[model samples]
Target chain A: MNNYERYMGMVKGEQVDYVPRIPILMHYAAKHIGASYADFAGDYNTLVKANIALAEDFGVSQLDIMSDPWRETADYGAEIEYLETTCPQCLKHPLEDSKDLSLLTRPEVGKTTRLTAAIKAIEAYKAYGYKEYSITGWVEGPAAEASDIRGVSNFMIDLIDDEEFACELMDLCVDVAIEFAKAQIAAGADTIGVGDAIASQMSADMYERLVFPREKRLVDGIHEAGGLVRLHICGNTNHILPVAASLGVDIIDCDWMVDVVKVRELFPKNTVIAGNLDPVEGIMESTPEKIHQNFIDLYHKVGNPYFVNAGCEVPMDTPKENLQALCKPIQYNSSI
Target chain B: MMDLKDLTEAIKTGNRTQATSLTQEALDADLTPQSILDAMVVGMDEIGDKFKRNEVFVPEMLIAARAMNESMAILEPSLVKSGYKPLATAVIGTVQGDLHDIGKNLVSMMWKGSALNVIDLGTNVTPDKFVAAIKEHDAKLVGLSALLTTTMPSMKATVEAIKSEELSDVKILIGGAPVTQSFADQIGADGYSPDAASAVDSAHQLLGIR
Candidate 1:
């Protein structure tokens, strides 16, 4: 079966040929295609090409359109600098100095700066994808986009100093995310990965109070658009796993520090749990054999309804052999 | 109830307005800056320990740090006039090829709260710049941060570049999400810390400071 079918099959609890490898590959993909990270992030054509090339070479199942958090932030009139080798840098957060909500309006998906570029990526993937891969579109989750425009430190303080203003800002952000997620779905995305990485930094109570409802809104919005949801939060999320699971997204990614055994028990069997491997140690600095064995052991422990992923992105300079070892498929283990 | 303990509690709870006012009140009431600073440090110390135990998360630490900073704005001038010096001068930054700075910034704030006299070089800092800052400040410690695993090599490169300089008495402290103690040893970092509060302890341990 094709990778897309294999991915959905596992989520649907159908026995697939193997667990699909849906590791997030952006910087690594750019380097793989000999394109600068600027080329990969700024231009959708380049992003699509790099993802395709990465899948061809490394056998990652998902064709991901996530380059950076600045896609929507840039469209909101933030001055962003695209480095040759790394993601774009927002020179100034639009609301960093003034907590001005008036400075940002909803960006039209096709007319705005970088959001347009992402839509073009979804369209481009649809054009050439041939239903062979699971095309994953992305949006910064409510808190993440809020922090992106307000600066992380400022936003964190806002959460404490003014919960009301924080909710207002996140309300606007979640609206934007919902709109963006729908557009990507309309443009032919099978799944939308909502990256609420900033939420992981807050206390579980703060997250449940401020972020979970908005994140739930975004997830429901995506599902309403006939798309799947992958909630991607970076850093240790052992505190918020139950709240995260309650969102009922199609998938939840556990970083290396998250409790994998708890996650396996927390997520329903059909909700594909991806990751819990240290990207730096398990993949980057590891031998191919060790990497393979670790994944195999992880797969067995986490059981079925899993996607093979590192805790986060595959480091750009990971040994090709290590990636190959990770991608090397194991036969479907139905009984696990 | 106008005690320094209130200042400590204000800082710990991240009540910036209260922290600043209490700090000023302490100053007005003839509480020496050092005693005030010590009380404030206890609040940070408690928060840091809670952070390490996962009883508190980043927001608590952040607000606590912000509160400490707000109070420091009032307290710093007095400390200087009283002939105060920091524990040591330290240089810190997110390594080159990585621009994510929450971890680095938190560590910087923690270091500053501990009276380290930190010279923050900001994000995407190159190894040569680190070396230059170390030399310029005659810093006793260097803390390198990178959020992405991709930039861990940059950490290694910075460590190597600094080691090659043979700065006789400088220690390198490395951290971020993906960094491990083994990675620290492999990269030749003098020390490693997983969170911001412990970073102060690590810095003190590395430098043999109280």
Candidate 2:
């Protein structure tokens, strides 16, 4: 089977010819076309070109539509400073000095700056991509969006000193994420990747009380929009794996600290799982032979429903050969 | 209304009122500065244990930490004036290009309450800033933190930079949600802890303070 066919088969819970390769290539894309991160995140054409080039060069089964963490907050009027080598970050949160929820306006997905461009790019990709391949879009989860709006430290405090406000903020973020997910679906995305790296920091109680409901709401909304949901929490979610699995995510992207064997146990049989490789140790700093074995081991741990990816974004300077090693086994081994 | 044993239990269960009231009562009863500190450490230690076991979480830990810090404010000066010394001096900070400091700050607070002299370098610390702080404070150990995979390199780079400067003897400790012992060894960090409580254990072992 072709790469796209294999990926679709696995997602559909059918037997696949091989494990799907879906690297989280962001800066890798910019480097592919020799464009800077600043240009890649800020310009729609550059992003589309970079993502397309990466999918072709790497033979990845799915093409992702993700930028830096600042996209949603930027639409709400936060000041963002872009960089060449690093993902763009919020210079200052829009609500840094205030808790006036009334001042926060719900951003219209397709009309927001840069967001519209993302939708346009996804729509553009569907026109060009072959039928077998799937396009994945992206949105910031509520906890991450809270960090973008109120700053990380402040939000941690808000969780305690102001529970009501925290819930309000999360409610607003969920609404915005639902709207954003819908736009990406309308723009031709077959799946939506929810980036909620910050949510993993909270205690299970706080997470259940404050974060999980909103995430479930957002995930439900994306499903309603006719797109599959991939949840990327981006940390050692070992303690919360059961909670994450219970959310009914199509794929739970594990960070390196979470053991794949443990994740496989937490979720039901046939739940799709991806990642847990140390990006620095296994890819950026290790040899190709070592990296390939790591992938082989990961596949054995999680079996057929797994997608090949790092715990998070592929490092900017990861040796080309090291990353290329990730797909070597899948390309050669029929049942990987 | 506040009993010492109950305070320790309260902190473990994230009971702030009992923790605070007992802390004040401990002071009012003429309990030795050292004794109150001992009780606070006991409470924090249990909280840390629960954290490792996944019984308590960040928000509960935060409340327990805040209660400990507030009590420490009243107790720290007394301990100092009584010629008490922190078990060791340690410095902590989050690496460059990463602004997530909730984990780092929590670790630092736990260390401070556990009787270590902690110098916080705040977020987005460059190697130069770290090196300068190490030299200025004469800190024996360094703690590096990062929440982003993209910023993990900065932790590795800081370790290399510090070693390259011939300050290799300075024991470096690393932690955060994304960091693991394998990553710590690969980066040449002297120690790694998954949570704030373990950081105290790491600090003690690295310094031979225990």
Candidate 3:
């Protein structure tokens, strides 16, 4: 089966040729194509080229349009500083003052430069007829987007002191995200990746009360748009896994700090659970043999409906052979 | 007549206004600034323990830290007037190529709550800046932070840059989401803490203090 069919089969709990590999790559992909992160993030053609090249060469199951967390934030009137090699930084958050929420206006996703670039990349992927691989479009999750719009430190304070304001801000972010996800789906993305790394830092109670419902809304919106949702929240999400599992997303990414067995137990049996590996220790520093063994161990614990990926973005400096080991297929034993 | 317990409770609950008022009242009652500061530390220590136990989280820790900071603002003049000196000096920042500062900020606040002098270089700090801060402050400890796998190389480079200076007296402590004890050893970091609360203990250990 092609990568697309393999992914569909695995997600559906049906038989597949092998486990699908869907590691999130950003700076790493830019390096793979020998392009600066700035150019790769700015130009849709370069972004598409880098993703397609990595997908073809490494046998990756999906091509992600994830360059950095600031894409949607930048389009929302925040001042973003783009570095030559590093992910762009949000210099001036639009909602620096929580009261400035009234000043904020959601940009038209199809018209904004950054969002349009991502949509155009998805269009390019479809134009290139890379139907065998799943093409993913990404948007910031409510909490993460709120953090981006109002600096992370400031937003965390908002969650405590101004619950109403925080909820209002998150609502705006979810609305924008829904629109952006729909635009990308219309532009040919099969999956929408929602990144909410900031949500992991909150207590389980806070997440359930403040963040989870917004996330559920975003997931429901994507499903309504005829696209699958891949939720990637980087960091230790063990405390919030129960709530996260309730979002009904197609895939849930567990970071290295979470126990894979616990995650498997918390999540539904058929939901595609991806990763719980330390990107630094499990993939970057380990030998190819060790990396493969790690994957095998994780696969054994979680069983099928699993995707091979690191807990977070693949480090840019990770060895090619290590990643190759990750993408390499393993023979499944029916008895196990 | 001021109740130190009230001050402690204020800090613990992250009631910044109450903490500030209680601190002022304590000072007006002729309470020694050291004793008032100790009360705030007691509150922060409780918050740190709860954080380690997973009973609390970043928001709670941040609020408690804010309350402590507010009390400290009221107590600073008295502490200095009484010829107070920090336990020791430490320099801290997120390494180059990383802009995430929440973790680093927590560590810095914990160090200050523990009565250590902190020279914060903010985020995306280079190795040279770290070395310079250490030299300038005569700091005994250097804390490095990074939140991205992509910036781990920069952490390694920063560590190498500090080591090259042969600052044998300096101890390097690193922490972040992607950082590990093994990675710390691989990069020649003197110490690593899994979380910000433990970072205080790690800093104390590295400095040969309780």
Off by over 4 Å in 2: A1-3, A14-17, A96-98, A130-132, A153-164, A203-210, A261-270, A329-336, B1-32, B74-87
Model 2 lDDT per residue over B1-210, tens place: 334777677666656676767777877787778877887889899889888887776767887787787778777777888789987778899998677777898899888977788999998899989999988888888999998777898998899888888876689999987678988998899999988889889888898878
- Local lDDT at B33 for model 3: 95
* Candidate 3: tens digits of C-alpha lDDT, residues A1-336: 888888888888888878899988888899999999888878878888998998889999987789888888888888888788878877898888656776775667657788888888888888875568888899999999999998998889889999998999999999999999999999888999999999989999999999999999999999999999999998888899889989999998888888888878888888888996788888988899999988988888888788999998888889999999989896553333
lDDT of 1: 0.88
* Pairs that collide, model 3: none
Once superposed on the true structure, which residue ranges of model 1 sit more than 4 Å away at CA? none
How many Å off is the CA of A199 in candidate 1? Answer: 1.1
Task: Score candidate 2 by lDDT.
Answer: 0.82
Range of the 10 consecutive residues with the lowest summed lDDT in candidate 1 chain A? A104-113
lDDT per residue (tens digit) for residues A1-336 in model 2: 876677777878787667787888887788889998899899878888888887777777777778788888888888899987767877889899899977765677556786787788888788878455778889999988988899886787788879899889989999888988898988888889999887777776677767888899998999999988999988777766667777778888988878888888888766778886888777788899988888887787677688888877778778889878876646324353
lDDT by residue for model 1 (A74-98), tens: 8877888999988789999888898
Better of 1 and 2 by lDDT: 1
lDDT of 1 by residue, B1-210 (tens): 457888889888888888999899999988889999999999888888899988888778888888998899899999999999888999999999888888898889888878899999999999999999999999999999998877888999999999899996999999988889999999889999998888999999999987
Q: Could you tell me the lDDT of residue A306 within candidate 1? A: 89
